[model samples]
Target: MSKWTEIRDGMVSALDVSDVVESAKDQLITDLTGDGMDALSTVADKFITQVQVQAESEQGWCMVRDKFVLPLMINGILWAVKLVLAKSTPATATQPEAPTGDSQQ
Candidate 1:
């Protein structure tokens, strides 16, 4: 095998993406749904609740403001989803944070 191939395979073997994916999926699924309901279903339920709540809020957003606000709302949801996934997956399964050396007085 080529050196690059060996390095790529070693990297892949070191990280079990399936474990991280499964763990993150499991967490997004709330127990709000009883047995027999799968993770996707629970994720959808939570997603709907978040959007519905924001839509129902008294934002006083007019057509001009909504053009900007709608996208911001979607961005907010994306941030929330990523945060949950990061929390669900083990620290070792994800990339390590870069070091910020040196202290400021």
Candidate 2:
């Protein structure tokens, strides 16, 4: 199971409603949901950071292996996807298009 799902299940299992009022239960649910969202946000942040690092490394590798068609294709696809994503969503910053040389084609 996913980390968020595990956290949610744990929270649900720990809730003691025998003596709690209905309003209190509602508050508890809201608090638990917030906690879950916080956890998810943390996980997402970490993933984005790792992806950024890996992408940088992949670019270096592509430079070294420029003659390989596979690397060029992979980089091209990544750039296209990034462009599509940036257009569909909000732009975090201006992202320049990936450089392509004659060897890439």
Candidate 3:
């Protein structure tokens, strides 16, 4: 998935975070009802829009992208190192045969 999508999904799904957002919206509505119920809705809508805008910004995208891409890059580096070590060591030298001492004579 793209970085922004990952971030958006994370925000929507993890840690009861959406509840917090909803709670904040509810609080705003309660506090700002003097401007009328319609104004409260508009404020809530604007808040959501601003969150989306921030998530899609370059810095947010890069942070989310690194969360995924960094692990894959580390795995690739580890695999390459293992491959090089395996190639350097002879198989026979590494896996020694069991001793069959000449007791069968």
Q: Pick by TM-score: which candidate is best?
A: 3
Q: Which 10 consecutive positions of candidate 3 have the poorest summed lDDT?
A: 29-38
The number of clashing residue pairs in model 2 is: 0
Q: Is 1 or 3 the stronger prediction by TM-score? A: 3
Best by lDDT, which number? 1
1-105 per-residue lDDT for model 3 (tens digits): 899999998977876744566556555544443354345446545654555455565476665554445445555655565555555444554578988897786
Would you list the clashing residue pairs of candidate 1? none
lDDT of 1 by residue, 1-105 (tens): 999999999999989676676555555443312232345446655765565566655465554344455556755765676566556555554668777876566
Model 2 ranges off by over 4 Å: 1-29, 59-105
- Alpha-carbon shift of residue 96 in model 2 (angstroms): 46
TM-scores, one per candidate: 0.32, 0.30, 0.33
Off by over 4 Å in 3: 1-60
Q: In model 1, where is the ten-residue run with the lowest total lDDT?
A: 28-37
Any idea what lDDT model 3 has?
Answer: 0.56
Error of 3 at 1 (Å): 66
